[model samples]
Target chain A: MATYLLLSTLTDEGRKTLKARPERLQEVNKEIEAMGGRVVSQYAVLGLYDFVNVVEAPSNEVIARISVELGSRGTVQITTLPAMSVETFVNAIKGGR
Target chain B: MGFYVVLTKLNSDGVRAIHANPDLVSAVAADIQAMDGKVLEQWAVLGKYDFCALVEAPNDAAIHRMAVEQESRGRARFTVLPAMDMALYVRLMGQSTETTGPHPWQIRWPVQIARRALRNYWIDQHVRAACQPLTVLGRENLDGLARPAIFIANHSSHLDSLVLHSVLPAAHRRFLTFGSAADRFYIKGRKGMTKQGWWNSLAMATFPIRRGAGRATLAHAEWLIDKRWNVAIFPEGTRSTTGKMSTFKAGVAILALAKGVPVVPVFLEGLREIRPKGTRDVAPGPVTALIGAPIRFAPATSVSDATYAMYQAMEALRLRLRAQRRPDGPEEAT
Candidate 1:
């Protein structure tokens, strides 16, 4: 699975939803896992963004679907970034055919 | 959560995202909170930047973490600046007791003005007169452009603001406050900001405005306006990548309508070709400054109408300039 970093913020309705049901966040995380993505880490941040998520998925199409699915829920706007660990990056760049 | 400013520029992917779903922007903000930041305020602005968001983070590490997440993606670019309230800013300003003022940048008044004048003269000599041949039309229209007027122009290149400032009469030029992008022009940190602030104040006659219409952005411009200084703003917010005009933001309209100042629509041509973004070549060209007749909206006119008329006026000015070129002379029957 490829790693993806998701930077997100809750919408007005999303904020209301979170305030009304704090458990909803965990439930949504479970839903994301069900969609074939695993949430490796998550952080609630302060500044132009609200949430940062590190996730793993099988492919670009899977992540695109995930971003669109979650974003379409009208609760959170998501910016998904592809990411890799430094070790993996170095190994790739080393290039042994 | 501590306050922070997020400056963002949308790439082609970002543009497509928004085109497909405008609500995606709000969702992205929610993503920030999910990342551990609280987006306190956000604005979509015209200019080089797409959005400027003020957020609150628990600490530097949290924001840095967010930065890493955002920057790793090619969808958009972000410049994060830590923010302090005015009270905290003043308190920090007071940390410097050596000067009569809170900051050294504010202490010097006369010398800064002299340096600015000299710099403008240099800009005139090297850039305006010698290197670049800048033409002027309807100088008579500027006759009525009084002090405290708002000069609204379309941004096409780095030279646009300077060209507008240079063409202004000295009486107005000395008092003109240019709106400059804070992230691009100045550095962070107290000492760095102070030094850069002073330099910008002198060189550009600029007041740094974050890329969007945050609460502080227009307020700062209004403060400058109230001080009887002429203010120049690029309604498009950023320079045009392809040398075409972009939509004018309502900020200029609101500022003019709220302050009851006459808006002088200044159309600049050939600036983009002369100095495109990311290009070091300052190619010589005939830069035309078409100063439209000053527009003053009625007290009851809405901001949208005023802004629309301003844009139309600018477009018309450009068209009129284009039509004026003939073998006899470049004189247009205005």
Candidate 2:
């Protein structure tokens, strides 16, 4: 599985849903797992985005689906990015494969 | 000089600080200029990214320093992107010291060929020395191999492919193609593969392919095979997180069937413990490659059956190796 970084912000409707049903976060996690992507970690950050999610998925297509499925609920707008590992980065610059 | 862009976002305190000091934006621009790059444009946007700044720097390093220094202050976080002129980019990619391109017919200088030869020789020697206790169990079995073929092996550690490439016979090793993830390895192109550019590309013999379906990479592999080059693939798709094998994907089977080539089953052991998935540490250990005989299916054989047979061969090899392994061998080097 490849690692992905998801920067997400809750929309007005999503913020309301999350405010009312805090338990729904776990349900979303389950849904993400069901869609073949696992949330490695999540954080509420102070920045342009409200939430930061580290996810692992079988393929790029699978992760894109997870992002769309989660965003379609209108609770949160998710932005998924394929995260490059330190090893790959170093390898790219190191000139040795 | 290089063009750069930064997408910046301010925190609540940053917003409050900005209100307190309306000159904060100008201060940011000055900071960018101080870093040897001039801010060309600035915009406040309403979205995930708050502010977008365009700058032209003397070099990429200047931009990197600017971004790092800005983030270190904790007022804002920036996503940095470097932009290059299309003409300059094409010139840089095309203007090799010795000419080379996607096609091999391109002429290269003798110095370029010599440099690559030297690099390959060094790599061969380096791997041989680095893997001191490496035992390739099936060398004799692979000695008789004469034609181009595909080698399917387990993926656990990052070192698997390197070690495999290092241990292969010269004929098999020469011009061998590895199916690397296109997204990771081909991020930008030749430079994306490695900083050394053309040299690294030739040394690694990496052919970038898409992750899921075999459409893009499969065709690349087939092309390489047609040119009398062998290809290596990890049919388990991704590396085994737990070091246990996963179901073989049909991509390998399809490639073998389409090319009408034999599929060689290779089993790697001990490398995972040395350097497993999701890790950067490299522990020294004895790694072994148990090579099995090639599995060739008849023309009428189904892809699924061929895949299953390949999987079964690898499984049986693992079992046999386990049965023969000693309980107390060379302990894993810490």
Candidate 3:
């Protein structure tokens, strides 16, 4: 299966938020799970961004939908990318394409 | 339970024969199972060995015995690896790597004077100065103790050790040694400051314990205690990642009982806020430490009974520390 990288950032509203509020992030995780995506890791940082999440999804469109749902929550901004494995890179190089 | 990774190499003839003989494969598996180990995985890989197997057994000796049995079967030479879990691996990584220079506490004769001054200035200007509201309780409990004792405290924050060490009187501090993990802190080739921190700890009489090798490490600890220096140990073995108490390892009780030393119970509050587990960042906050009366082990008490008594004493001390609350008050050293 193709792996899509899903990255999400907390919105200003979420940045000022306390962890005691579970509903906001819980809703986002549920949407990603429903789309057959898995969160590989998540980190709370002390910089320009509040939190960073690394997720694996089946396809770009699935990741886009997940990001849209997260953005609509008004608590985070999202970025998604199609991630390629080293095996795929090796195969492409050997394929002469 | 012990986790063992078994590496085996088969002669080309034996490999060909095993491929042709299902009975041979079953026989090998049966022999391993007979040694009281459960095979978790068997993998054929492109390496020197024909196959690798992961097994769980009662202990290291059982795993070693199984490896010997497998090799004697004349199919393959075998080697075993005792697996240290990932959590332990990460902790060891943190402890072994020295990211900075020799700590201010570890310096030569001439530089030692400057190091001590710098340490005092840093503690006074940074730690003590930054935190406006700090309180110390239970000082009398420590001063009242007349005999050599073991101070056991909950492992909450990294600052827990520093706070305890700082607040202790010079005489007591001279006699007291803190216990740290040997695999991490005391190892050579670590980074500068990390090495320094470990050196400082050693200067303060901190001894190192090798984790996971419980029985062997505990015996070493008993020997250290018998040397008659007052020692401080966080019985939980490791810092509590969560803000709750963890199960204390039996090493402390084993050492205390063998040496017949009194165990002094201590509790530190607000240290988690100052320096949370798994982080290098420090937060300014009010912190308090409470030292409870030392509990003596009865001469006739068995090791198990003394262990139970020690646990009870520590629990009671924790309760007292948690109960004390001063919303608006001056910081007092107890």
Candidate 4:
């Protein structure tokens, strides 16, 4: 199984209005963990948005489900991007496309 | 300053999640520090997220900005929380501090002497008035209780102590003093009845009990009792705002057993609904007091054993009082 990084942004609703609810964040974390995805790290920021959470899952599909779960809360918009290790990056660059 | 932690993970592709990007995390941390927030610690974790960063800011807003900056970087998410000092929290919630506010009895006092005179007069009058209405169930039990005793009671409202004070004979009242917290009552900048309560208590020979001072405060209480002043302790340590009795602390039991004083149990009812906790307003209501037969302390008992026994006896008395008040239904009793 391959590990995938899950990056998410709190929507405007989440950042400005729903940020006060610590229970919501707890619930989100619990849900992700129950689904076999690991929350490797999490941060609550204040610049452009409210929070940022880092997650690790087995596949892109798991990341997609995490994103949908966040979106369904209607508190924040989420965007997920797949990441690669330095070794994979080196190999891909060496393969010439 | 505010503290924060960031958790994130790396994806299958070379691109990192918003929470996991090293550059973004560093920039966000720098931004927070530049804005007067202090970054305490940042580390990578294996479980929930890729990394966790702890930062401290001047205010909540600054921390919020830091969280936002990290999010826009598209790496990870975060949760921020405010931390409280345990000592401060315990002190604020302890029984001694609970009574430092303006009580229903304080409105009549112009100064310390006036407060004492008024309290004496009111207790006498109220005790006389309550004699016919208030049922005396355990007086036979208290008869001949000559030794210095620790009077333990279920606190409901401001009137619990007042009513107890009224019922005790003038001699017992003279030797007896109730515990009140210094921080709440004697603090330098307090206003209104709280300050007045402190002064009135001092004038009435009520000594200050520092909350959460632990064994030291307990030692002071022992000294006062050993000096033969009957000390009335609210073992629940604070009044119950919900009208239901809270769990009693072991300090009362410890003091009682240590001093070899009889633990006199008193149950007060209908006081919470009358004045409620943390308020000065009094709503007219009939209040009742049931003084349990005093339990004697044996010399063989250790402080720990005595503390447990005290709690058991108190809990039994509380249950008895609850049963009396709600003889027919469980719903009426707390």
What's the ranking of the predictions by lDDT, best on top?
A: 1, 2, 3, 4
Docking class of 2: incorrect
The local lDDT score (0 to 100) that residue B154 gets in candidate 2 is 89
Per-residue alpha-carbon lDDT of candidate 4 for residues A1-97, written as tens digits (9 for 90 to 100): 3444344555667654443443456567788888778876555544433445557788778778877876897777765545544334344444653
Candidate 3 lands at a TM-score of 0.53
Q: Candidate 4 lDDT, tens digit per residue, B67-114?
A: 777556554556555433222323333323234432323222354356
- My TM-score estimates for the predictions, one after another, are 0.51, 0.52, 0.53, 0.50
lDDT of 1 by residue, A9-68 (tens): 789988777655655676667888889999875555556667656678998899889999
Give candidate 1's whole-model lDDT: 0.71
**Candidate 2 chain B weakest ten by summed lDDT:** B99-108
Please report the TM-score between candidate 2 and the true structure.
0.52
Stretches off by above 4 angstroms in model 1 are A1-97, B1-112, B120-122, B129-131, B189-195, B326-334
lDDT of 2 at B111: 36
RMSD of 2: 21.3
What is the per-residue lDDT of model 1 for residues B298-326, given as tens digits with 9 covering 90 to 100?
99999889989999999899888778766
Weakest lDDT window of 10 consecutive positions for candidate 3 chain B: B98-107
If you score just chain A, what TM-score does every candidate get?
Answer: 0.91, 0.93, 0.71, 0.72
Arrange candidates by TM-score, descending: 3, 2, 1, 4
Compared with the real two-chain complex, what DockQ does model 4 have? 0.03
**Candidate 3 residues B274-297, lDDT tens each?**
777656787788877777777877
Estimate, for each residue in B8-105, the C-alpha lDDT of model 2 and write its tens digit. 77888777676665567668888888877788665554456666555767556777888899888888888776654332232333333232222232
Q: What is model 4's interface RMSD?
A: 10.5
CA lDDT, candidate 2, residue B93: 34
